[model samples]
Target: QDVFPSKGGSGTGASATRTDPVHELTPELRRARERLLPVIESLPGPIDWAVAYGSGVIHQANAAPSSPLQSPPMTDFLLSTPSPTQFHTSNIRSNPSHYPLYARLLGGSAVAWLQDRWGAGIWYVSMVRVHDLEVKYGVISTERLKRDLEEWETLYVAGRLHKPVLPLLTPPPLLPSLHANLLSALSLSLLLLPPRFTEHTLYITIAGLSYSGDPRMSVPGAENPDKVKNIVAGPGNLRGFRRLYGGLLDRIPGVRWEDGKVAEKGWIGFNGGDGGEGEDGEGWIVQPSSPAYLADLIPSLAPRLREGIAAHYRAAPPNDFGSGRGTEAGAGAGAGAGGTRRPYGSPVYHDIAFWERVVKDPQFRTVVRQELRKIMYRPALTQSVKGLFTAGLTKSVRYSLAKIGKWWKARQARSAV
Candidate 1:
């Protein structure tokens, strides 16, 4: 499949040219990768990519002075493979201990089915001892991962990629999709955010997208309540966010950073929209990056998307949108310039003329939140159910207990404060 599939964009004004991001390992990330070298090497052949992520791996952006001193080493990894069936087949044979007895008996076909078809399209093994370290890892198909990245189909792995990662075995082919994922996160976050906000706020929004409607987050002690803040609060974490998204922010149309308030040492600010220099603003602009972003992101709410597209398309005149239909022909055809007149109910995915107007709907953000909940809620619940089998009841219990304990500690700490 093409790495960065085109979304049928009409490149008009400054075409926010984007490319694959280069991930240079920090000292901590380098150490972490080196630690996981054995596991990386031992994995089955033809693995598309593998990366080490999670709290134990790195400082997680810029850590504020007030933040906790050190995090326990986390050995969380995501492996993207072309053939999950083959990969699982080999893994089950090599490390039968990784899966429960039922999973092994069900065979690779069944396990792969669950991973692809169920809960956010991922299968994870927890509390795994790789060499001297206890590691947890998730497996996903390259296609499924790509879909989540490009289509926001699940926002599972895509949300994880929104933050920086330690690339143990990344290849060039996957870069475009990775960068596009970040851009998508940015586009959605800008839509959800207030007119003006801090860079921390932007990163927070991006980081929280996956968990927004996720039951794992809502249930008491299932997840750390401060998970979002922890991921985004520190200067180290903020710095990571900056490295991943700073250049992309510049590429976004009608966005500019505030005066000197944007600091390289982990501080960033920008005014809302293309507003003038001296107005009450947090710093960055929140416009819909581009027509393509607006066009591409509307699919979650397809009916609304179609309605918006059709309405926007019909409102414009023929010549106005380069529809090629003269005034009279367009009226007769009931199509807008640059838009094909579909029957009463046809999906209009890529009409630039329509996106210009569709994004401006007063209820865009509110409706987006509703649609996103509809898209995310069920998968989040189902994935946790799948975890009982994928990770095994024992491992799931252990992991959940560990998470609950962590949440309790955080709650106590916050309460004491």
Candidate 2:
């Protein structure tokens, strides 16, 4: 009979024999794997073995119609052992020269730099550890990968990953060490604004300013205001700003702020409405008259705006600006029960609102959304599966399963004998 084994019944020997153990490896894939093998072999610790998996292991002579081969086949390495830390440390120590490349590939150096600069070194490293591995090994779904890649590309364009080695990777690292200050300023701006207006143009403007260090910070009139204006208002400036804003916002959580007086004020500020002053009351007058206000209109405001922008770029810590869960009551109390009932009215809030308006502008929105869509669905875009695994490395999972099958086959042979 062609019947399969029932639940509690032993399957025929065919079932066991049908399982295949070996996987074919292509020449290019084999070469890539070989290159990484030495790196893995040098890893210290009690690792029993290492292997490659996925398309790297599939071994195809030519690219399928669906997946064209533009570059060398990428391979993901899985080191089998009990301790992950020891393995990772050994892996890095085994090849320090390659560590920068790994950092570049995994998007960790920017994270590390931000953490160190912002006094949140521990949190930044922790985020790097979590996100880098996940991004490296295809641990996330395709949709999520698209989102992350979009954000990374934005950061790259904004000059966030200006450090060495990062540009070598296809997508490049999000928020590199050199551009942490710019990223931080952009983050602060996002925190200050509503979600809808947060666009790439605003963030890029901030990034450009930070890079130039306008000197308007400690020294008034130290730099040319025209230069700053040129950078912020030049052609394609808006697009750059949008990416910077989007990238920064992606890193923050619960970005949606409550609608109220502060939200309204923030909205007005964002909409270029002179922040609701109308020549009366103490509101954030967009077109200010005071010398300080004129100085601040760009320069003074730039520094304050940068504070919030930078905070957002750095992935605002839970306790930052009293943003943690428990601090809600305290923040509310500090704002006073009857005091305007606004969203966190810090300078960052104002900057965020301004950028949000720029992003939401119909013309700007249409262009950016189109660009983002194009980036999202680009057919030739290649992501490294090796760098995509966070929760579990694919190679490790396949290797374990293969070993189990091999062991089972040996046991079946012994029983038959």
Candidate 3:
């Protein structure tokens, strides 16, 4: 498979760019959004940008009938401002009760300090009720928002944005950044995915990045293992996912679509140096990356990656990215478990000699996985801890008990199985 195209596609083949989340709204979605108007309107301080996410948005978009047992899931907001300290300062006066007693006593600067310095780059105020609807809003500086989106440094807010998020208050200048950040996310996720995967699996992999190695997952039913899958597979969500990711999808060289789903054709790289094309000379499969492919790819991926990758590409082996040790036999043209003739090449292998040396290194994939995990794990654990405090005593206790109960049930079910 040719991971690197000779030319970059404009990312808009025949389809138009879908930049505005408003375009996705249906009557049902609109009505559902209406219910949160009070919550949105009640935000106390200035916001550079704010997005509404979580089960609340999904429920609204799906317009499922409400259940009395579940007071509509909290309308969650990931908000950004020019200055979190200033915003919180102003907001503290307007909504004093939203702050925990300690946060209030310490002041907004202290809250912001704790948020950015100790927890993830957000200070959340949960269980704030407005017009009979519960809401949880997290505030962060626009700087942190952009940094995380570009670098995946935290993968906290970026992960939430990966799923469908209703952009409520977007500044015009930030629109392009939002679009690019999402594309970068898709590109990174694609790199991490196994060569063979279904469309839904692709989204699941992306969604799962945020939760990778999260300790909460070990706590029985602390998190629904199916949460990511459900988000991607839910009504209207897959369409939303495609709309958000379609432009970037159009740019990938050999993505094959069938029955409205997409996957790599088969194998990667060329058998007999033929470039993975069939007799018809149409369609390409997902393959290992070549050095040249990686050369092109590093630049094409998120900007933060370019610096670390460029030197590796230039040196051509025996370095950080393992561009130094495998052979043509090791990197290309191998038999699969199913007895299929598969090219056994690194996803980024351009030179045969380089592949020969690099493949021997063995730590290449591990290094990449470790780097990605490090970005996600700490932030997730910090957020989990922060949630206990931000949720307040009553809400925190209730939430914890609910999680414990769910965990117990899941444990029991597993034992029964």
Best by lDDT: 1
Residue 269's lDDT within candidate 1 is 43
lDDT of 3 by residue, 248-312 (tens): 66666654443322223332222111112212222223534544433233334444333223223
What does candidate 1's lDDT look like per residue over 1-417, in tens digits?
Answer: 112121111111122222333354445555666777677567553466677777766454222223377435547888777788888898899888889999899988898998888898899888878786788888888788777776667677877888767676555556777777777677677767765566667878988877887878878899888888887754355546666777777666555554444544233343121211232223454454554556555443223223433444354432335444222233322343455554434434444445554465555566566656665788788888988888778788888888888789778878998
Clash statistics: count for each candidate: 15, 41, 30
Residue 124 error, candidate 1, Å: 1.0
Point out where model 3 deviates above 4 Å.
Answer: 1-23, 60-66, 258-295, 303-363, 405-417
Q: How many clashes in candidate 1?
A: 15
Each model's C-alpha lDDT? Answer: 0.64, 0.30, 0.58
Q: Evaluate residue 10 in candidate 1 and report its C-alpha lDDT on the 0 to 100 scale.
A: 17
TM-scores of the candidates are 0.75, 0.21, 0.72
Query: In angstroms, how far off is 223's CA in candidate 1?
Result: 0.8
Arranged by lDDT with the best first, the candidates are: 1, 3, 2
Candidate 1 local lDDT, residue 186: 76
- TM-score of decoy 2: 0.21
